[model samples]
Target: MTRFRLRSGVVGVALLALAASSCASDKAGDGGAGTGADGVKHGPGVTDDTITLGLITDLTGPYAPIGKSLSQAAQLYYDEINLGGGICGRQVETLVRDMSYDAQKTAVAYTELEPKVAALPQFLGSTTIASVRDRLEASGPLTLALAWAPSVLGAKPIQMTGTTYAIDVINGVDHLVKDRGLKKGDKIGHVYLEGDYGDDSVAGSKYAADKLGLSVVEQKVKPTDADMSSQVSALKQAGVKAIILSIAPKQTASFVGVAATAGLKVPVLGSNSAFAPQLLATDAGPAFLGDFAVLQAASPLSADLPIMKTIIAGYSDKFPKDGLDNGVMAGYTSAMVVGDALKKACENKDLSRDGIIAAHRSQNAWDGGFGSTMDFTDPAQPPTRKTYLLKPDPKAAGGLTVQKDNFTSDLAAAYPVTAG
Candidate 1:
């Protein structure tokens, strides 16, 4: 509102703004906004002082702990940004929903959140994301993919953090050979759920085995089916020297527990989704004391790297009493990537969903403080071939020791973009 004092001989001036239709039509999705005749632009979830984003995670399901930790970590960054006046001077606010790691429920949640938020920064479950993608594409929100399924490459608004699960597998297998002195022809065991996530990991392992002239014994388990005893039995009977697991935390717990009961003692390598902080307290915790290793693309908290240090300091300062682990640290890093995109979107004052997507296109080998380089220009291509190696360290940040930081293998070149 404007107030003015005018004398009888003086004239009062009225200010008016003109809407630029060309610019209005030039923003991001059906989620685009209307430009007022007065030149005030209002996009979905973007207001004078607030920009709303959505977060859909597995709050109450098997990945609940992960979701909770991730959300907390994201909030830490978002809150820090907010304290600094946020992006474009609008406070960043994320509306979170728990889909319980279910695709149908995620679809419902996405539909509910689509009309109200500019983008989604946290979406867990690769297969679940795949199941509900039609719903997502219909109302395109820039989504940060927690699941690294190769099928996600080139999918609009879905930026994958790490390489595909298959590639992660390739790196892990090669690591075993070089670091663990795993010889060619050594029988390796694979225990994974029956889904895209599992398939991607298995593909990498199989590809690496073929290249190295080794053999693999696979034990497929359904996510819904809890019994891993049979799978353990099969691998044990095969005289597998080591095992790789590409499953969730609950499934991981079962794998470790069931293996011990079956007297199958071997080093277990896990994919990113395979480890959780709470797993250390489970009955199988003892078995994983030092026997379990999780392969990831992000730097572990134990690293002296700037990104890890920032996450640790910020997280500890923000939520001191809560434990810091991989799940939460991963969440923090994901938020950092999203924050970078948002900052870019703020330019030109067009914060529409489409504008955010465009911001990604300009990204080339973006560090995002995680050390992995990401190229969003060709979203379909693999972003990075690097992997971070971490072993369980309860006393360390994220409960893992950083054995390697963004390390690549000679066999990494052999990994293909098979996820697409």
Candidate 2:
């Protein structure tokens, strides 16, 4: 397995202190250290009574439904925190904005809210974050990344909250070869997005294909690409035995439309981002019934695990009529992880960016009530990631049937890490 290296704890702690000191002027006051001794909060967006977190997302673009679902899920966690008296004697406040998934808009939005929020828990999309990454490091709030791209992960002070797309695909293709009955020399088709997320998945798929002696026929689509006929048509001509799809919601539907029309009879594997339950309600629904599987970052509420039960109840309470989804679960788990870090930082009386980062980095094997756990501290620690394999099941929550739990792929370990 590939390993990541973080600075030593002593060094990391010192850096955190230094970073906090550097950004102290951005805060509202000067009493920001060593406890609630002075009963004043020193960080931007942090006060004795409130800690405001920011969210940048697309609520009107093609991914609008996803954005709304994510926001709702995050709100669920924040509501719980506030109801329970909040962190460090302050209520958690979240300010959300619709960037429409545009990079320029994200930059504009961040500038307007940067000084008012302590951190961002759900800033999304690779392009949007990349546009404002450097600014985030110098003065922006300590944020949790929703995008697991290497670039995003490398952007310090914006750490990843889940497994990266590359690692997730590395493990996913293993399921295809080992468990899904594929052999060496079998043709594999990769239909992916034209971005860091899709490219990483393709890289992982290629890595596994090479290891297993499988051949791959690849196709790419833009984020806004509504039709995938040309891409799917190429895969059909390639005579692929199985497909690895890393496209978005609309693209997934377009692929399904093409696949179903072509009479293709192969199982399609996908990254976590590929599965949008809304597709199941569309005409493409039948195409997903038995032929599709998605690798997920965390198990859904259907596992009936105690933590999942809480998630289901919490989600129902807030949006009683709406169904849960991967987007929602992603938002929930990410917020939970960030919330844990914030609470921990509060314990140390430094609710600044460095405090949050240090608090997150100090722990190992932490689960944050999500059933699955991973270490965020040591640099050399191999990503001990587990990808849940889920197939489409109308009866299941989010229309996905959990096929495997805590499944780690040997191929995932073999794939190289390019972001260290």
Candidate 3:
């Protein structure tokens, strides 16, 4: 695990004080906190009576499908919580700002919304979350939840709900090799986006490959660049038995299609973010048909799981017109965790920021609709290190179905040697 060093005590105190003062107006209740006549509290972006949480997402960028769905899921959870009279007699409000997948724009949005709300519970994009990490840490421990893998490990003041970026890829690859009964020396290929996200996946794949006694033939691509024939050609030349991908939805589908076009027959395994059902429903999806595998940090969306059912039903009921995808599930899970913290915070007192963080850090386990348990007691690290592995449903054609419930066990077994 990577260790993030905290600032000196003096600097840390100054940041904490700044953060406290930012919320001082809310404490003063002078147009700062509490609900107003319209039932909204006005702060940085909050009005009277409501505690506003700001979300920065890519609503109109390459990652819009993910951002939009995630936003809807959080809204659905908020609506359900509010209907039940809210957390500690206060309604939860969400304000979303489109970041367009740009880091700079995301930083601007975060800067704009920081002083207006009681708390910024969750923000969706990885780039956006990373962009605001230092500011968040300096601004007094604002809680941020993100969808990208790198942000969880790289950013401060953000807690991830599942395995870290590198771990997700390592877990996914290990499952593919073990469950599929691949032998030692089997050639594996990786197709990934070429930045931190891709680097993390590549690093994880290398670690898994070393453990499984396999070899890797790697290919890299930009998330926005669609052409993948050249990279697929290289993987095919390597004669890989299985391929792992760490990419967004569009690129995942495109890579699968290109690989298939090059007459490659290897199974294509993917990280969690690549499990979007909508992408699988497309024409290019058949390339991934029975050959695709994914790692999910949460429970599968089966009717047998009450929590999954509730999330799906509640989200569908609340946002009837919006499409629900994996990112939405992630956002819903994030909100559920935040809600749990709020409930814990409000059990004996009002929903204050300190109380919420304390509740979060004190949790032994969380049942936030996800099958994997979340534990945050380790003060030195963020919560959540478990993961679930799934294979594409051969019967359903492109749909992913759970293969193993606690795939993180495999990762844990390999950890002593793999951790950097």
Candidate 4:
């Protein structure tokens, strides 16, 4: 496992105080420490009554459904918190922007939000976030990324709410070998987008294949390439036992629908972002119900877990027109983490960005009423290796059912995820 080092607590606290003091303007304001009249220390995006966070997401691209889901669920959580007196006597507000899954737009969004928000809890894509990672490392807010690529874990302030894409693939492949009757020397097909998400997932598949004596036949595609007839044909000719997907919902639907029509009946598995609840209303819906599963870090909104019951009821009531999906669970959980960190910072009386980061790093065994507890002490490693394997279901809430809850195969647990 790879690890990134943060500054020592004492040094960080002092430096943060100095930076806040040096940057503090003489004029009264709400975004900087000592800028307000209350005498309580605050940071950018913070005031006497509100703490503003940024939500940079894709609302017009392939990931729009997920972005919407995340935004809505997070808002619901924040509303609940505000109703209950909020964190540190302040209401949480979000400065939202639609980056459309574009890196350039993300850069612009970051520039616009960086000076006004205290933190970011929903920066949506690996590629988009990577575009601005350098700036983030230099002076970015405490960010909770919606992406799962291992590379995102390198930044000090950026944290993922769940396991990486690589671990998800490792667990998915392990299930294929142990439970799906795949044997040594078998061929497993991988169709992925050509970026951090795909590359990391392929890395996991290769590692698991090497351990299980299986061969990986890879097919890389661009996000714009929606038709999967050729890729499906190639994998069919390769005679692969199963296929792993690390693309978006459009690609997954096309691949599965094409494969089904091509007479290739193999187990199809996907990363968390590969499927959306809206897909169940499409022509590919039937194919998704057959031999297709997804790996998720959080439980579905329909999960039997107690917290899920509250989330589902609240979400249905809050967003009547929107459909429930895994993004709802993911967004709510990420907000929960952010709220916890803010509360800790309040207790320390240092709600500055540095204080928030420090508070987040101290969490070692935190549970958000999810199935698994996470350890956030190590920013380099995923908080947990346990993942849920889910299957699409037309009748289920979130349009999916959990096949394996909080499962971690031996291979996944043993794999060493390193920095690039």
TM-score per prediction, in order, is 0.85, 0.87, 0.82, 0.89
Please estimate how well model 3 matches the true structure, expressed as its whole-model Cα lDDT: 0.64
Roughly what TM-score does model 2 have, to 2 decimal places?
0.87
Candidate 4 contains a number of clashing pairs equal to 0
Best by TM-score: 4
Clash count (model 3, backbone only): 17
What clash pairs does model 2 have? 4-379, 4-380, 5-379, 5-380, 6-379
State residue 200's C-alpha deviation in candidate 4, in Å: 0.9
RMSD of each: 12.6, 9.5, 9.5, 9.4
lDDT of 2 by residue, 194-226 (tens): 888898889888888888889889888787788
Model 4 lDDT per residue over 1-420, tens place? 001112346434532333233222322224776534555568888888788887888766556656767877888898899899978887777766778788888899888788888888878877898899999888888888888888788777888888989999999999998889999989999999898889999999999999999999999999789899999999999999999999878788899999999999999998878887777778888999899999987877778888998999898898786667777888899888888989888888888888888889899998988877898888788888888899888788878888988788888888787742
Ranking by lDDT: 4, 1, 2, 3
Residue 36 CA displacement from its true place in model 2, Å: 4.2
Can you write out model 1's per-residue Cα lDDT over 311-350, one digit (the tens) per residue?
8888888767567766677788788888888788776456
Please give the range of 10 consecutive residues that has the lowest summed lDDT in model 1.
14-23
- Which has the higher lDDT value, candidate number 2 or candidate number 4? 4
Query: In candidate 1, residue 172 scores what lDDT?
Result: 89
Summarize candidate 3's per-residue lDDT along 1-420 as a digit string, tens digits.
001112346434533332333322432322243434643223333334555666666666566656666666777788888899977666777656677778888878777666655565667655566676777766533465665454444333466666666777777677766677778989898887776677777887888888879988888777677777887888887788888888777777777888777788877778877656776557676776657777766665552467777876777676675545566667777777777776775673534445456677778787764667777665334355566777665343124567677656566445532211
